[model samples]
Target: MNGILFEKMRFTCQQSGHCCCDPNIIVTLTYRDLLRLFTTLYCDFRLLLQKISFYTLDSTTSPILEKQMVLETILTSDGKVIPGLKKHSKKICVFYSRPSCSIYSSRPLACRNYPLAFVKEKELIMSTWVKNSPKTCPGIGKGSPLSQKNIEQRGKRFFKEIEKHNQVVRELNVEASNNRPLTAREALWTLIIYGESEYQQRQK
Candidate 1:
């Protein structure tokens, strides 16, 4: 990743809701992200399922894009799956309302870390603007300079959650290979259950 230094950048959300509505972007979710939505929406798993889209990859998937997936591909009976937010028939994010995201406070990490992408190298955190962020996005170079400490904190937390999510997927994939493969719904429920257990443990 060609990352910029956080200290050299400046950003403040313009709130145009363009990112939320962008058809080109797929807002993928980690287990924690899904759990956040589950609790935020009052534990309505059925409602949550309706808002999720399982992107199934086949031979047509781009090699570079496939390599960039942070989470391991889940072996579901349906196919190799990556869960993300479902878009409307018109291709806007399902949670997107007129001028903003309805779930802004509990938005997925993909949305929370928008405009910037973070990666850790050795002991350092590196950062860069998301390659697909809308060119017309007014927030890119505007507002006060960003805080490096804050950026690092978010980056670390982001990767910590990703690691936890990856562990769950890895175990699920191994189990699928050893036994019968999971259905898409089954894999999702597994994630939700795992996330909830982790959350409860943290509360202790």
Candidate 2:
């Protein structure tokens, strides 16, 4: 019975609208993400290079500042904290139109491996990302089929990559504290230049 049930559990993405509408969708980008974004937007990387802002977790009601942080953390009077980051709307992802992901080539890894989550313990861990109300993604139960084995394998790889990405952030924090302010780009560089397992593996 277990074997029969396992065999029945396979997924093939139909590119329904559900992925875009997922409320839990979080968009965290690294340096590579920015480069891809620039390329996708048809803008020169140098154009964005000159203007980079450091995001600090603070309140600034000041109207005088020309530049405002897109991402911020807010603390309520009750001491509850919230990230001021804006979630990517299903209507907004360049690839999210009617049928499928438009920018599949440049889409972030997080998007590529949806419905799967990774947790960092002593090592990378994989788990299911089930949604109670998958409003937009109608393809969940109807689409092409993917095997459980493939999903598990991909999840493991994804988490390892993410862990490396996190390490870069940790290293950047220390470096920024010792030196000057780091921009979004520089922070991204920390991830790619340092976190690439290929490079790290070569060193050992």
Give the number of the best model, judged by lDDT.
Answer: 1
Deviating ranges (above 4 Å) for candidate 2: 1-9, 21-24, 35-43, 46-91, 119-124, 130-136, 143-145, 185-204
User: Model 2: which ten-residue window has the lowest total lDDT?
Assistant: 76-85
* Residue-level lDDT for 149 in candidate 2: 75
TM-score of 1: 0.95
- Per-model TM-score, in order, reads 0.95, 0.58
- The CA lDDT at 136 in model 2 is 48
Instruction: Pick the TM-score winner.
Output: 1
CA displacement after TM-score superposition, residue 13 of candidate 2 (Å): 1.7
- Alpha carbon lDDT of each predicted model: 0.88, 0.48
Residue-wise lDDT of candidate 2 within 11-123, one digit each (tens)?
55666657655555544454445446556646554543432223333345454331222122212222212211133434344346556666678766667666544443455
Per-candidate clash tally: 0, 9
